[model samples]
Structure formats: structure tokens, C-alpha cells
Target: MPSLPKPRLRRPARGRGSAVAHAPEPETPNVEVVEHDGLRWVNIVQPRQVDRAWLEEHFAFHPLDYEDVFSRNQRPKVDEYEDYLFVVLHFPAFDKQVGRLNAAEVDVFVGPDFVITLPNQPIQPLEYLFTQAQQRDDVRASLFGKGAGYLLYKIVDDCVDASFPMLRKIGNKLERLEEDIFEGRSGEIVRDLSNAKQEIINFRKIVRPQRSALADLERTKRYIPDDLDIYFDDINDASERIWDMLENFKEVVEGLESTNESVLSHQLNDVLRVLTAFSAVMLPLTFVASIFGMNVHVPGQDSITAFWIVIAFMVGLLGGMFYLFRRRGWL
Candidate 1:
């Protein structure tokens, strides 16, 4: 069987000062560079102001783009410029404090000879891709051989693809909650559903705008050269697939929530019906006792047998009312 053709990254001229072939040389402890076939992949795990200054010194990125590198809350977007393309994209990172998935921003600068990744927080797939490029020569040859546009494709594509497992998790949770609903675990299921719903909402927020941003990425000028839309198109399709799953999950959770509410309401009604029937039975018995306790002369009030008679009457009335309730299926 034939292997699939890898998308192309523009191969710049192997100019003077290019790093040795297949070596992932580090510019600093935090900044790592992988050079192959005249392309450089510079990855900074979390960029600081000093790193920002280094970038300004090394590259001619616009000041606004530099500011964007430090901004964690920038929405998914793409800014095309004459010299480079500045892209902002979000991927999911589970926050332990919030107990759900949240968007993590990855800011990218793609140029003719280099692709720089600045993630505001750690993303596993991004880290893995960079690590593989660092440790493996074949990995570098295949990835960095493509120009900056194609490298950008790889980063966004991997990050977008990573979301599928998370989607499956959300789907699995919804499935489990559906089963637990029937097992009469309304309390626990309610909380689980809420968490799952929140995760889905967070995931939707990440993917919804990203779809358009990816489309915008495709239209932006090729930084390394022209012709890499196929790669970005693949990323867009993946984003759309994630959005589709979120839509289905939104519907499923809503349905489950409505079903849960109905189950709760039905259980409440059963308890209320029983209480109402018991209260109805107690009303007459209370009236008879009140009359007997009055200071005014009452029939047979002075008789010794009155006490036993009242007790017998009360028991009879209780049994009668209980039987009536059972007959009506209100018990």
C-alpha cells in the first residue's frame, strides 16, 4: 500500500547560520528550535515579557501581535500582514479548580522560514509534537520540511484533533447518566449531568469561533509561499466535527434534564398525595377530641366509659379513612 502524501512546507534556502541538520537546538531554556530543510520551529511553552523582547529583537512582528502573545483572553482570530500571519486559536484544557474543561489560547506566528508557537498554558498535543520534533530526526524531516504554512497546519490540526477524545468522554458521561436515571439515582445523576453540560458548554465556546478562524487561516496569504489550503481545510473539517458533536450533546443533556425533572416532580407528587390523604383523615378525629375536651357539658362526658368510647371511635375513624385512601389509590 502507498503512504499518504505529506502536505508541503516551503523550503527556504539553506542560508548561512542555519543549524546543523536534524538538531533541535535550544535558543534558551524556555525557547526551543527545530531546524530542518531551511525551516525553523520555535516553541515557547509560556512566553514572558523577556521572551517578548527576544522576539522583538529576533523578528519584525508588529507591536500589536506582540501584545497579543501576552494576552490570554484574545478570541480565536487571524491577522494577516505583509511579512507574517498572526493567528490566535483556543484548545481545551481541563481546569482542576473549575472541575471542567476551559479554553487555552495558543498564539502562533508563521513566517517564510519559521513557525513560532506561544501557548498561554500547556497543551499536551502541542508539547508532544514539539517534543517529537526535538527528539526524532525523521519527525523533524517530515514536519519542518513543509514550510511555515504547513507547520501552522500541523499545530492547529493536532490541537483540533486532540479534542475528539474529550468529546467521547463527554458522550460517555451522558450515556452513563442516562442509565443511572433509571437506576433511581436522581441526586447523583443531577450533579453529573450538570458537570457534563458545563464541559460541553466550555467545549462549544472553544470550537464555535475557531471554525471561522480556521477558515480565515486558509484565506490568509501563505507565509512560506502559496498553496496549503488543503491542510487548513482538514483542520476546519475537524473543528466542524467537534461543533457537531457539541450540538448533539447539548440536545441529549437537555432531554436528560427534562426527563430528570419529570422524575423528580412525579416522586414529589407521590409524597404530597400521601401527606394530603393523612391530613384529611386527621381532620375529623381532631374535631371529635376538641368537642370532648370543652368545659361545657357534652353528651356522656361524665360517664366512665366515655374515655374508652372516644378511643374506639377514633381508631374506627382512622381505619376507615385509611381504607378509603387505599381504595382511591392515593396511599
Candidate 2:
């Protein structure tokens, strides 16, 4: 087997008198090279804004790629430059107390010799990958140098895979809510379900564009090497799966919402029915009492037994009305 050539170590640029003159503006950290298993990787962490002069002096990244690093809140997508490929992806994290998905953006630059990752917000998956890379030399080599393209694959794959745990947590919550809805305690459950739906909707908003972006990348032949195409396919497939899960979750939530509304409506109808029945039974009694209380002379008002007669008639009327209502199932 042929031996891999040793990777050249490039020192950071310094000013005259070797007094490490920090660039007036912060420079994106230079790539850190790690080698193992005959592969080399140059990992670039969060990239900061670089002046044109600094870019010219320090590295050979395309000006447009540098422009993308400074671009604010870019949608997930891919761009092919003459010398490298640019990709943007979002990863999901949980806001535990709020119970929502917080997506973080990661912009990547992959070239023949280097891989640069820029994250606008805290992304858990990439941090996990970095930790793993630190622990495993072989994994570090596979990510850093065997192919810069492979590093892009690892980062994206890890991001996509991290979504599963979040999705599972949402699924379990949905299940618990489903039980609550069935148990006739849907007020709190419905509200929580609504929050979950919103989170899923937000997640879909973030992931759907990435799906199209990955699909676009898959079709392009300019930037992705033929051998690396499979990795992009994996990313696309993962995007599709995430989208499908979100869609299913949306449908479930809509169904649960409908069910919650139905239950509330039914309970309200029952209350209204009971009130109507009570009013029906009381109507005749009220009419009889009103007639007896009037000052005008009436046959019932003339006799001492009239009061007893009215009372007996009222009782009989109320009983009959109740019986009729029960027979008709209106009560």
C-alpha cells in the first residue's frame, strides 16, 4: 500500500519583529489540521467576518464564499463556486421549558483541501461531532482529510440524525395528550397540543427549504464529485423523512384539535339540554301560581281547598312533563 504524504503545517501570519499582530478586525479562525489513518482534516470552527485584505493575506477562499459567511440568516441551500462548494443547513434543538424546537443555521465551505463550518447559533449536533472527533483519531481523519467532501457529509448527517430525538419527544408528548383528550381533560391538553403543532410547523418551515436545496444539489454536476453524490442523496433522503414526520404530526394535531372541539361542543349541548328540560318542567308551575296570585276573582281563589288543588295539579304537571322528556330522550 502506498503511504499518504505528510500534511504541511502552516503557521499563523505574524507582523514584523514576530510580535503576533492580531488583525485589526477579528479573522475567522484558521483551520486546525489533524491526521490519522493516512487521512488529514482541517477543521475550521465558527468563522467571523474577515476584511478583504485579511482574506487576501491569509487564505484562498473565494470572495463570494467569504461574502456568504457574513450573510445574515441565509436560507439553507447550496452554491457551487469555481474552487469550492457552499452549503447551508439547519439543525434542531429543544427549548426544554418552552417545549419548542430551536433551529440553528450552519454554513459550510468545502474545497479540495479544506472544510470550513460557520454556525450562526448554538447547534448541538456539530458540537457533539466536534467532541467525538476530539476523542476518536480515526473519525477525525475520516472527517478532516480523506476527502473534504466527507466532512460535509458527516456534519449534515449528524444534524439530520439529531432531529430524531426531538421528534420522538414530540411524539411521546402527543401520545400523552391523546390520552388526556380521551379522559375528558382536554383544556390543558389541547393548549399543549397547539404549542406542539406550532413547533412542528416551525420545524417544517426550516427543513422544507433544505429539502429543495439538497434536491437541487443532487441534480447539479458542477460541485459534487460523482463519488460523493451518495452522501448528498443521504442528506436529501433524511430531509424527506423529516418532512414526512412533520406532515404526519400536523395531521395528527389537526385531528386532535377537531376532536377537542367536538368534545367541548357536546358537553355544552348537554348543559343546554338540561337547562331547557328544567325550564320546561317549571313553566306550568309558574303559570298556575301567577293565575292564583292575581287579584281578579277566579274559581280556584274562592275556595279554601283551592290552594291544595293548585299544588296537586302543579306536581302532576311537572311529573308528566318529566316523563315525556325522558321518553323522548330530550332530558
Candidate 3:
């Protein structure tokens, strides 16, 4: 809730005979500032609160970097500048309306004294880190005491770590789906599997690109300290691991889908086979009964027991057809 000291542009001292007027400070509503140990962490939530004008006036970020802040759905990337590094990263967020996880972009400006984060939406990980930084002295010290680069790393690390719980939820769903598939209780299992697959795909789409960005960060070694390469390397490794897990889940989903289709096909074939056998046996009996019912029947029409005889013949014919059908494996 605390605010950072308002930044100002320095000017030459006025002459003794001169008078000066000061410009009113601009209003910043979407910006949240957390200051610790002479370090400033500024978080910008959305585009409407600040634009290119504010960004330029405050941090003087590159035109392209601040231009990207107004946009949405940016690809993950890292750009190194003379005094700072501009990094765009995506974090996973669950969209309850869509019933799937989606990627939210976070644009970071890492400088010597401050780290600024601009998110397309209210990102949970960033909010969580902000809260921790405010309440936990250890977290504040570790993040701010080190440097801006380390603080940036901590934010990114938390973002990456947040995916694990989502992934675990997906894993649990898949496990239940697998059990349902084997137990032949596939009611709604297909839909569940589909949902899980979509989440995995969305997660992969969101995260796979970030691995390259993280690797670039590690290789560039521009914003972070030299000793912090290991931390970035570890993050890159985690990205790879997460990607691999998603790929495996994708394969499992495909296999399960194939199996489900196969089972459904087999069951349909069995029903068709039974229907065909019944139709085959009934067709001849119906024909024979129609023939006997005709006014000018040729055989066994006048005998007192002729009705019984015809019924016996029809029964024998039905039995013979069914026997042949069964022998041929049609039923």
C-alpha cells in the first residue's frame, strides 16, 4: 500500500532574481510501488492507466519496448539495452469462463535501481510476489537487497513455479480418465479428457516459447549478475521439464482418444451384427406367412391340421437360417 517517492526531473538552480513554476504530478492509479533497501519495484497492471507518454517520461524505455506495453498477446522475448533489459514473458492463467488455461503476457523492464512489470491482466503470481514482498521481511530482503536483476529472477521463477499446481490438476484428471476408460464407465470421460488435453495444449503454447526466452536471458547475461547464471539455467531446465511433461500428456490423450473410438466402434459393430441376424431370420418367415395367407395357396390349404403343419415348417426354416448364420459367425 506504500507509495514510492515521486520521481522528478532535475533542473539547474534558479537565479536569485528569477521565479519558477512546477508542473503538477501526474496521476498513476494502476501502478503499485514497493520500496525496500533503496530498491524500487513498480508494477503496472493494464494499459489504460499509463501509456507511452508516462513510460517515456518516467523510465525512458525504448520506443518499441513501451509500445509493446499497449499491445496484448506478445510473443515471449528478451531485449538487452544499454542500461536495462526488456523482457516479455507469458504466464499461465485459468480462464473460468472458457474452462481452460490461457497465457497472460508480462513485460518486464530491469534496470540498475528499479524493476518494473507491466502485465496485460492482473496476474496472480505477480500479485502473490508483491504481497510477499510487502509482508515478509526475508522475501523483501532477498529480492530487494540483492539487486533489480535478482528481483526480476524471483518474479519469473515464481511465475514458472505456478504452473506446477495447474499441471498437477491436469495429471489428476488424466488419471481419473484412465481409470474410467478401463472400468468402462466412460460417461463424460471423453469430455473430461478433451478438457485436460486443451489445458495441456494451452499450457504448452504458453510456456514452450518462454524456454527460448529464458535461455536467451541466460546466454545474454545482461540484466542478471554473472553468478546468477545458474539460477537462470535452472529455470531453463525447469521449462524443458515442463514441456516434456506436457508432450507426454498429449500423447496419452491421443492414445486414450484412439482407444475410446475403437471401443465405441466395436460396440456399434456388435449391435449392428445382432440387428442384421434378427432381420435375416425374420425376412424368410414373413415371406412364408404371406405366401400361406394368399387366397390361392398351392399346398396344404384344405387339411384340418394344415395350420399346424405350416407353423411347423416356418419354425424349421427359422431354425435352419439361424443355425447357418451362427455357423458363419454373423451373430
Candidate 4:
């Protein structure tokens, strides 16, 4: 047979490539979109109280879910619907003004062909990850080539991984505080321990509820379209590990508080012991001076030799008392 006829060329679009099957979706004030390889990722940043109508207009999420999304400080949880799954996850984001970690809540909706992320606050890692998948061809291929389930797993996994660095920072701070506790810096260490303890408590509050939610993820499926049990398990394991670390930190901080209190108590006892010893030594000398200073017939009041003898006797009494204190181990 002769060579095949030259293929009739279908010209690519004028602006964008042919691989993009649809025109780009317009973004609203609080919403952004990234599409690649037939997968769509919608990211909503800090939606306002009235923005639930937008979500309801686009997605058939439950009213309660919308309430949870717009609400502040919702507990971390996972709610499985008939055609979608709603997940709430938390990560510690530091608040520089208050100088502590605050829980950033991200509500996710996973469906057959799309993944939606609605964060209650600006999460830098989530923002960065979404941007990477949106801008970089390789990142988009790697992340969107997989199904929605796998993409969801990666999103949660990246957030879970970001916590380790914060944990490391907390660990280093505790080590330094442990050293300062013994270096006569208990005054400062007391405040340090309080701040660290508060951070641990807040972080634990974030991780504890989220652990159960992540564990329930694999079972709560509808349109996820992939058997990502292993991937979800990995995220679950990471959440468990984070919770364990926070538990350990709680105990460590409590122990530090007790140790600091003990050090302070010991220092107080040392000061009080010195004051008591000095007061005991001065009692007899004070009585002797008072008696001689009175306008009464004291024994050594009339003679100069008597005054020298009295002075010598008082010096001997002082030496004797000092010797007694040294022998009693109370000096």
C-alpha cells in the first residue's frame, strides 16, 4: 500500500493548548481554580459569612457543612455524604503577634473529578502546594494524574508533613529551657514554660480530634474513585505520630513546670535559712546591748576593764555561735 494520506490537521486553539478541554473558570474574590489532566482543584481562602451561597450554588454540599466551613474553630472531623466527602483538618500556624501556634482549619470536598479546599485562615503550605500544581507542568501532572482520592491524600499528607518542622522547633526550645532551668534563670524559665505549655495545649487540641477523622477517611468514600487505603493510612499514621508528640510534650512541659517550682522553692529556703541563722546570732548580742544601755545598775557598767571584758565575752559568744552553726551543717 502507498503511504497513508496526510492527516487532516485540526488546528490547536489560538491561545491555550488543546489539552485543556474547557475554558478557564473565572475566579471570585475568595475562590481560585486549577485544572490539569481532567482534574479540577478549587481553593477558597477564608470565605466570608455570606459566601456560603456561592458554595451552595456550585456544589450540593449540606447546609451543616457550609455552616461548619464558614464557622471559626470548628472541630476537625470527616462527614461522608452520598456523592462526596467533607473533611476538616487542622495544622498549627504560628501567630507572630501573640507569639504562639494557632490551629488553621481546612475543609475539603472530594468528588469524582474535583477537589475543593476551603481554609478558614491562610495556610502557607496549602497555598504553596496549590500554586505549585497550578503553575508547574510537572507538579500538575504528578498530582493530577492520580485520581481525586490520591490528590486528596497528597494535600493532607503535605499538611501533615509540615508539622514536623514546627515540632522540631518546639523540641529545641524545650531543650534550651531545660538548661536554663538549672542555670539560675528560673525566673525567666517560669515564663518560658508557661508559653511552651500553652502552645502544646493548643496544638494538642488541634491534633487530637483530627486523628480520629483521618482514621475514618478510608472508609468514608463515595466519589473518591480510588482505593487509597494505604495512602490514607500513611496520613493517619502521621497524624497519630503528631498527637503522640503533643502528648509527650504536654508531659514534658508539666514536668518542667514542677521542676522549676522546686528550684524556686529551694532558692527560697536557702534565703530563709540564712536570715534565720543571722537573726539567731544577733538575738543575744541585742539583749546585752539593751540591758547595758538602760539607766540601771548593770554588772560592767562602771569600769573600763569591765567594758573590755564584756566586749571579749561578747566576741567569744559570737565565735561559739558561729562554731555551733557550722557543726550543725546549717551555715
Question: If scored against the real structure, what TM-score would every candidate get?
Answer: 0.83, 0.83, 0.87, 0.88
Top TM-score prediction, candidate number: 4
- For model 2, name the residue pairs that clash: 40-144, 40-145, 41-144, 41-145
Candidate 3, backbone clash total: 0
> Candidate 1: where are CA atoms >4 Å away?
1-29, 224-227, 302-313
Candidate 2 global TM-score: 0.83
Compared with the true structure, all predictions reach lDDT values of: 0.84, 0.73, 0.82, 0.83
Model 4 lDDT, residue 119, Cα: 87
Query: What is candidate 4's lDDT per residue for 185-239, written digit by digit as tens?
Result: 9977777899899888888878878888877786665655556777787887888
| Ordered list by lDDT, greatest first | 1, 4, 3, 2
Which residue pairs show backbone clashes in model 3?
Answer: none
Over 4 Å off in model 3, which ranges?
A: 1-27, 49-53, 185-187, 323-329
Question: Please, what are the lDDT tens digits per residue for candidate 3 over residues 1-331?
Answer: 1334476677768888888868786665566778888888988787564454556667667777766877775789989889888999998999888877888888988888888898888889888999899889898998898888789888988888888888888888888788888787664577877877777788888988888898898887666779888888888888888888899889988888888777777878999999988998899999988998888966778886988988899999988998898899897
Error of 3 at 308 (Å): 0.9
Write one digit per residue (lDDT tens) for candidate 1, span 72-112. 67888998788778889999999889778888999998878
All candidates in order of TM-score, best leading: 4, 3, 1, 2
What's the number of clashes in each of the models? 3, 4, 0, 0
Selected candidate, larger TM-score, 2 vs 4 = 4
